[model samples]
Target: MLTKAAFALLLTLTPFFALAEQAIQSQHSCFKGPFETYQGWVMRMASTLKKFDQEVFSAYFPESKFQQVQQTLDCVDFVYQVDGFNVEGYYLKPKLAVDKKLPVVMFNRGGNGRGGYVTFTRKLTFQAELAAQGFIVIGSQYRGASKHIDNNGFDEFGGADVNDVVALMDIIKQIPDVDSENIAMMGWSRGSMQSYLAVKRLPNIKTLIAVAGVSDVHQGMAERPVMEKVYKKRIPDYENNKQQELDKRSVAKWAHELPANMPILLLHGDKDERVNVAHSTRLAGILESLEHPHKLVIYPGDNHGLTKHRQEMISEVVGWLNTYLH
Candidate 1:
């Protein structure tokens, strides 16, 4: 259940709290002061996504379309704690009847530290897109990682930070409209690893869809040497226990330990330079040998973000979630 503090923080983002910079660290929000209203977040994200689509991804997105999300979604931001460390979270859902509950999707995002943190812009656009599809969507910036909100603790890549993912579950349970029993997880890049670690703890997660995720950090370090730097920096006690540490993040090492009934859908861009496509291909082989129910899709010539196949991924994701989550 949301604490008085948590509930009060939510109040700060409401229309009534729009002008109250005192309600929060005003600079950490979407507008001139702090967090804006849902309508305002939607408008800002629509504009930002449009620019990203135009200059950054016109070629990849097509003549393209930048689907401006309808303002029917209620998107909000709040701070939660993981092991007592303040962590930022994004929550979104359709403006349905209060009694109408919806399946949940915990979207684990890619990138680490300040670079790939889950921002308010993403909550309104990407996560909002999923929420628009009749699901309640939530995600964490993970402790110690944020574009806003200072002193969020440390991100251990997949260490204690996994608690941030788990912490979201507690908050989700407190929400009246959240169908806590019906849940799905989708992770991208580094988030894929986070999802695996989280699913290990969240055995009740119905299913998962990992897009351009990392299955084996062992292979990840080998394929891209730069990842070692990330490991050394983000992963705690790496030098003292490199093998044990990497193994924990690598799903391939213990895929059999996961709930056997939980089907998984793995999507990757074959041409991804960031995280190797082999991670998925090799993991697919392991899942097959174990007779696990999993589907793997490889997008040819697509980048790490699968920029060329964004629409296709959405269709696949929606179908997968509908089939399993329902």
Candidate 2:
């Protein structure tokens, strides 16, 4: 027999499950926004996820990337409060002469462990390229990295990750130099999911970019044998809760909900070993079917991070942002 709360929970989750089954059936279908539930609690939870994502983003990145914008390039450390936790991140802003009002670029790093480190900031060797082009680059950090515990909660802080970028934008608006209207976000791997989903929920974003990000976590895990091994090592029953969490975190499922006219770019490598190229391939199909404004670029002989053509990737990313953001 189910308790009252358990019964209520079931009722709340019923639509999502039904929708998931429908999605699986179609193999290719349009993603609609969240269905209104009669249960107020569930609605509150979804609303909270969106608000929490925004607040956590604000609290985690409270200031500009640099403590002093004396040099042409510098990384600044900041903190934002999320669910009572202090989430830390690095802000990388470019200082241009004559005080240029630069477009803002948000960086979402890869992996659950990756954070505001300079090394993982992508090998886009043109670190100063964005600045040269007059853009304020913000590198955000999600939960479970650097003093934060692993987010074992359902949805894996997916909505909260979206909030982080939005909050960062809030911080930028307060800054003296950055142009709030021309803002874009780009992420690789885990960070790509964060950026992609954030844009879906919040369409105020002007530009979007994802690199080597998987459309479905289950498919991604299936393709990468090492990830399965990793899951098994960490949790003997990886198929249990981990699967649930990944489903909640995947961006491919939610990207279609994004507004139709937003400029979005997808980049992937053919020979990637970590995350399959199918992630982007499948995503492109969804975007095309939905008739969304998006461009998918496939690179040959590139790996997980697009390391083979790092410079080319950066040039393209900066170029994309320039077209939309600038």
Candidate 3:
């Protein structure tokens, strides 16, 4: 009984109605902003939640402490297009600045999938602790992370994911206040692997600080079975080309490729269950063999990330950055 024009109108409205329903169900917020402070779940682009691969893990943060800390620092959530994908990250600056060109620290996060994505609380803490020390701090969610709606697809581990960090460097260089020449890298756990790959490729890196990082992919896969499964799922030829793919990720096998002048500060905890202390130890041996300038510090009675010696680790990291990057 409907007229032809009415039938056409109904068809046109059907997709929009379904889209509206989907948006409501997924709670998608198209938030692209120059935000004043840190906020979690800030939308990266005008995309539906259905487009993102939902993650199961949720980071537990002490909101009150983070709120207090964030008040002292200035932070913003920004996006940069990399390889045709919109990557979300945080940029932090100290409240007080003494120099026009401040040194930069590219903070590489650990973990794959949702586990490693930078949370709102993490952003606040990084700003308060690191950025407050008069350095510009940049951290990306990378690809396959839950924070960004359009992540780089699946976890490439240390493969193309390294480009995300490199792209962040390019993004930092464009910022007028950042000291592009004086750049340092700080990576923890899985991020250390990314850092190792990145440092070998990025010549501008003045110094490196790798904390409880996985230096050997084979050793890491043997230690963490869960990671092996994740890698197999993401890597195309992982089943047949296991060792080859792993060698590409491991730094212990290719320490000589790193710039000789680039000083590295290796920090590890003796009690690190997540990533054994031997990873750093073995890499240190390789660096020494290669006569690469580096320092390896193994903390006693500390877990991964040195949670027990948090303050001491921060002090050492800041000192190392000042000594080398500054």
Candidate 4:
């Protein structure tokens, strides 16, 4: 969720996005998914071709028919209102859910803008996978990550943008079959920071999952200068407020503030180059000192994305969510 590389192809869908925008009524705050949008129509065509001819499918469409490729993973890329701004996000769930009201998994993605956007395949497939497993996987594209949805306002990283996440919590309650009372949140990379801040206000959060998360802004900026530049662009008043803004975003400065009752699962690769593993480990230690309920998993020889241990990470996440939220 940290890398900006995989989002290029998604930009190509801008025309299709414009078409899909017609499916939703802006007056409606909470709309159901599987809408007959132009993109969905394209994917249906691609899926039909993928069943037989790969070459033809590739030739016909610019990308894979990912939306229809999944077995039972139903995903909905949605746009909703949050503090007068249209926030972009998605929700994933199994086509055949066993429960009348499904437990919630609100995911927070990493990256500032197009940099961390994952909707078409990467993030969509990941969240869809969890949905296939029975949880309602809902996530935010924050405010300004406008790949498809014409969202308003700027992404304040963990500042005002956090309200985007919090607003989704209340918004989902209106969406039927969602177990708003029992909620679990997972944040990846910078999304981890958003998760930390969002959970602070959400006492109802059953559990927190931080995958390759950032616990400290200052420490992360020092290690990854590129990320510092990102901070400057996304975080408002970065030039003048600097340390104050960074401190406000950094969970390391206030680890004790987290609820001891709500358990946390910290997943980080020790060899991570983007955000140092020290972020999770140090935060884990602080949480330990504070007697918080948490489990830290440090994968050896893994990078920022934890690409090598993705399946294992998925298992750990699913297992943790089951333990607390299911």
Candidate 5:
């Protein structure tokens, strides 16, 4: 008694039902911690060319058709200790194992103090996407994130925060089957500044991905007056010697210090308002002048997070990690 239309509708609904079943069956924590864990299916969303052209594209896009896509991944939360404080972080692994020796990517979060903490949803989506590609992904909540326990109350911008990432390497070493030698890093916004500083300290890192990063602290202070206030508040000697403190954080002033052979991929959105595209462009020029290995890609009409070209940006990141980290 079922018509052809009914049959098609049933077929369309079948996968969702199966997904629901799997969601129930796979509902178990993969990692337990003093940190909370989020493990379940997550909808994967991406923007299209039309959305980008409209200049209305944002990470908060709710109108995109791609939001209907029901791809999901498993996620877990855990904690790693740094400097005698229990720092919160997440460890994500693919549902299916591709290799016993899985590559690792340390995701550096953006913002300062409590502004940049990676939440449960981001751990399940953005971090899980990389994990689904067969890489073990980890991220830090760092020292001063909101609601963080054992707070040391130090927000070093790119200074001690870089050590937090370096300490993660020790955690990575303990992770079973993780290829600690093939480690890579991805940083967005303020996280990019942390990545720049981390690469200098950790020579084991194979490749660097800097997205909407701050390359020049002095330039950033100049571009955004509020940054000057932030610097003065965070850096103790900012009032006495601003340039010296700025120079400590500015990668543009010390491109020569980065590992000469290590490759860096810089991604920026031309329409980025938080951190200007000029940050990446200026660093590209400096790297080129220094003959350091680097690549710079600019997405037109995209914002600080490269929200318009989400899929392309993810693809490029995976490709770069595949080429360099694997």
Candidate 6:
């Protein structure tokens, strides 16, 4: 009787397992639309998510906590190697269901140096504000902290930097609940420059927000008396290398090639010291000349970090993203 019962149980389980395998095969068919279509919808989703970042996401949904405040939130960290360098990053999700895919924001950081909270915590002080609001926030540490800088020779916003960012986006799409249609990218300082350059290669970027970005680093540095002095003390051949890399990098000169009518929001402090307000000013000029869709927010008396105006800055960014990505 016991042997007979065991045989019956095995018979009942076999069909269910076969059905599960069939379901998996059906989902993997790769024919058309979202999962089925390779370059079409997949690329489309990537473009949509390219617009969002910490500043905008927090402004839209500012509860502070991932779930209790406003939107659903989850924290995930992953490690990946870019340009032969091991790097790590995190993802922030809103308090929402996986049934309906939500928009995503790519939040990039600035500065060559690392702050204690900046690296280990992965709190995304500014980005958390956005994730609480409603968007998925993704952040990756660009290779090259002071300790690894000289030895790695990693360009803060070089090809490898862009490659890693796009790779992260690719991973985000694999999530069942992420909406491929709504996405954005935003950054400050080095990240700002990274956003400007990465968007050109990524078509899925529905919107872009670059705050105090270095549009033309070579030109920006040469024009700045302080940065120039620092550069001379560091890399004496900065000018020669800068010109050689300009065509491959510099966003200001390549603005015409960027997506037309794609919403772009730029913010900079009038009194920014480290990156200089000119970076935003010059970029705004380029956008105007190209007749692109864009908005420039110049904060009065704000410095590089905009410490006093952070909340206000966050509000403006979230508003811009909602205007476009939503």
What residue runs in model 1 are displaced by over 4 Å at the alpha carbon?
Answer: 1-70, 98-100, 147-150
Rank candidates, TM-score, best first.
1, 4, 3, 5, 6, 2
Model 3, 6-51: lDDT tens per residue?
Answer: 5466445321122222111111111124222233432321133455
Residue range 216-297, candidate 5, lDDT tens digits: 9888877898987778767766689877878988889888999878899999999998999999999999999999999999
Model 2: per-residue Cα lDDT over 238-300, one tens digit each: 567786666666756666677678877889999988778898888888888888888999999
Q: Which candidate model has the greater lDDT, 4 or 6? A: 4
All candidates: CA RMSD (Å): 5.4, 17.2, 10.7, 9.1, 11.5, 13.2
lDDT tens string, model 6, 148-267?
323333433455556666666665665446776788988888787677767777887899988887887676666665555534433335567756554455787778878785778888
Which has the better TM-score: candidate 2, or candidate 4? 4
lDDT for 186 in candidate 2 is: 80
Clashes within 3 Å, all models in order: 1, 9, 1, 0, 0, 24
Per-residue CA lDDT of model 1 for 173-206, tens digit only, reads: 7655778899998899999988988988889999
The TM-score between candidate 1 and the true structure equals: 0.83
Clashing pairs in 2: 53-160, 53-163, 54-163, 57-164, 59-80, 59-81, 60-80, 65-76, 65-91
TM-score of each: 0.83, 0.68, 0.78, 0.80, 0.78, 0.69
lDDT score of residue 148 within candidate 1: 56
| Candidate 3: clashing pairs of residues | 143-152
| lDDT score of residue 2 within candidate 3 | 44
Question: Could you arrange the candidates by lDDT from highest to lowest?
Answer: 1, 4, 3, 5, 6, 2
Residue 298, candidate 3: how far off, in angstroms?
Answer: 1.0
Q: Against the true structure, whose lDDT is highest?
A: 1
The residue pairs in collision within model 5 are none
lDDT of each: 0.77, 0.60, 0.73, 0.76, 0.72, 0.63
Prediction 4 global C-alpha lDDT: 0.76
Q: Which stretches of candidate 4 lie over 4 Å from their true place?
A: 1-71, 97-100, 147-151
**Candidate topping TM-score:** 1
